[model samples]
Target: MKTFYWLVKRELWEHRGGFFWAPIITGGIFLLLNIMGIITAEVLGASHGIQIGASGALTQVIAEMDSGDMSKVGILLDVAMYAAMGLLIVVLGFVVFFYCLGALYDDRRDRSILFWKSLPISDASTVLSKVVSATVLAPAIAVVVGIIVGMLQLLILAITLSFHGVNVWQLLVLAHPFKVMFNLIGYIPLYVLWALPSVGWLLLCSAWARNKPFLWAVALPVATGLLISWFGIMGLFHLPTRWFWTNIVQRSLFSVFPGTGSLFGGTPHNAPHIDGLHALDLNTTYQLLGSPDLWIGVVAGAALLAGAIWFRRWRDDS
Candidate 1:
């Protein structure tokens, strides 16, 4: 347990600079864009009011928007939320990819893995540390960045709306930091679970990479899935490649939350269940989690993680 904690802490310490500066960089970019947006909107509103011979009418209209108009405000807030979420996801994915890619490679390059191997830690602990870093620690950092960015986005939105004369008290309340943080806490475990497959692939790559594993890590599975789908033989092996794509792409963490009955509006609609199976109000995630495809993903993930550990334990270092 002590060794495991050290391994985790050591990985964090190495990457702390990147993890710390990422949010600051992202927030800066987002803040700049938002400020420009506010300026553009104000100029547009002023011009619009001038065209109607009401010098300050547009400003007054912005100020006069009441709670009843919260729906409109909500739409704008959603835009900001969506953009920030997208940026956060991209950044998180890249960080995970790079971190895992570097973990074993860096150790091997510096003969640091040998030093650790000489320690009392087992192979399981070595691989498990990487897994935990990818699955838990890396994502946790990204979530924190997301929350900070989200809060800043919310503040910008509120201030922009106020400048336009919109009282965004209710909107601000909905975007409260504590509420968002708690909601994130509730969601993290599920997200980690959902992301396990990718983390497993990353671990596999980190273990196996010689030159450029990211390219292969991404392309190999995609190519395999395509070939299997094209041969129409996935059914023979019970490999539901199509279903895996849908769940990972559509239903996974960092994806949009589907509103009622919508199911992301992208997937083919299943027939409305006339049976008892669909009567319950379980979240759409029920379908994602319960799908045989996701289980297959889990099995594949387990295999990958196991293979990584096996390879690291027995493979020649030369």
Candidate 2:
């Protein structure tokens, strides 16, 4: 148990810089935006107050002139804000993915896997620790950073509203900030499950490939699938081609987890190459379990994991 924790800790310590800098940068940007929004709103509202008060006719004309336009402006603002947030979150996910890949790949490239294998730890523990680092620890750290940034942004917004003579406490409470937080909590688990296959493949690729694991991992399967399909179309090795087409039911290992969207299911994102592909539904899940494709991923995952262990175990340490 301690060994597992130590392994995970060591890996995190090595790569903490990448994970730690994102929230700080994102939060700073969010804070700046919130402050600017508050200042702009206050200035605009104050500038228009005298004109609005002096003539009801002028006020009505001003409202009429911009009523529809205001909504469009608001929508644009919302899109921009969400886009920024989404970009931050996406970067966080990317950092986590690449960090895990780097960690796994680095050890192999540097011949450090053998050093760990010589320890008392089992292969399962070593691999599992990296999985924990990628799936759980990384996300946990990112979310905490997000929450802190979010709270700081809210505080700045509130202060700005107060200065502008608007009470925003009810708005804040009604927004159910805590409920919003809980919803995010629910999303993290799903995200982890969604990310698992990529994480696993990253480790396996690290273990197996001597160089450029990313390129080969993607290119090899795609090349194999295409060749098989071409052969099937040509009526050469028809059965082999048919089996290859059928068994690639899911392109990503993440698809094997229950409740992944149709994007990863049965076909590669509904591309034109695979004709007669059905949208993945609950039925597709059951069908996948019964199908040869799921079994192949299962067997392949097991074999890769076993091979990673053996590679670590028997590889030259000197």
Candidate 3:
């Protein structure tokens, strides 16, 4: 158990840039851009002699807005937070994709596997540690950072509203940031499942490819997809080419992307104004467990991951 912990820690130690700093840097840039945007708007408005603070028309809009309208405002805030998080998850996908692509290959290329092979650790432990790092730790860090960035963004929004004489406390109460945070955190486990296929595929390529693992990882699925499409067009075997592209090729390559898990099934259906805008519907999102595709992908991923471990155990040639 302790060895396993250390293995994961080692993975983190080596890949801290992808697992931690990528998302942190992304969130920082996002906040900075938003702040600059607000400042620009304020300066432009001031130059135009358009004062927003306590304007009678603006006050009238606030005064006339009912609970429903206020909830819409809250949804807007939720969307902002969701957008920020979406960016982090996008970074997570790319990070995990390349991280797994190189996890085993790098050791072989640098001849560091010789040292690790002298250790008591098994290849399975090392490979599984990378999996856990990609699916669990990376997402956890991104979510925590995203939540912090989100709360700060909300604070910025509230201040902006205050400057315009709009009371934002009610919107804050309705926004349910804590609920949203919990929702993002809760998605991590399911994300692990949804992500396994992509992770497994990448790791398998990493462990098996002697050179240019990235090229192999990318070309295999894409080439197969192209062949399937061409044959289908030529009236071969009546294969569902479109379905194959979407479900197989795409999932194998891109399922590590967050929200793509259930393909936006997490969106809150209760938000009528936005017609299914941001936020997690735990009930609906959890329903993916009932999906055969999810489990089928899981089985395939486990098999690919097993293959990765096998290759890592024996194939050390760079």
List where candidate 3 sits over 4 angstroms from the true fold. Answer: 233-237, 264-274
Expressed as tens digits, the lDDT of each residue in 1-318 for candidate 1 is 988899899878888855556655876787788889878877897877633214456556655777667556554564565456557656766676677667666777677778878888788788888878766776677667777777778888777656645555756754335644554444555555555666666677777877576676667666665776788765886867676455543332222121211233222347354332122223433445544545665676678779888877875675
TM-score of each predicted structure versus truth: 0.74, 0.65, 0.92
Instruction: Kindly list the per-residue Cα lDDT of model 2 for residues 1-318, writing each as its tens digit.
Output: 888889989877887776677756876777787678766866797787733223445334434655566545343433333334454566676676576456556877776766766788887778777767776776667666666666666656555545544444633443334543454454555445445555556667665667787776567666777976765653654456656543442334333222342344333334344222122123332343444444555556555566655654555533
Give the count of colliding residue pairs in each prediction.
2, 0, 0
Q: Return the clash pairs for model 2, or none.
A: none
Best by TM-score: 3
178 Cα displacement, candidate 1 (Å):
4.7
Q: Output the number of the lDDT-best candidate.
A: 3
Candidate 1 segments exceeding 4 Å error: 44-68, 71-79, 164-171, 174-179, 222-287
What lDDT would each prediction earn against the true structure? 0.62, 0.56, 0.85
**Candidate 1: worst 10 consecutive residues by lDDT?**
253-262
Which run of 10 residues does model 3 get worst, by summed lDDT?
Answer: 265-274
In candidate 3 the C-alpha lDDT for residue 26 amounts to: 99
Cα-based lDDT at residue 249, candidate 3: 81
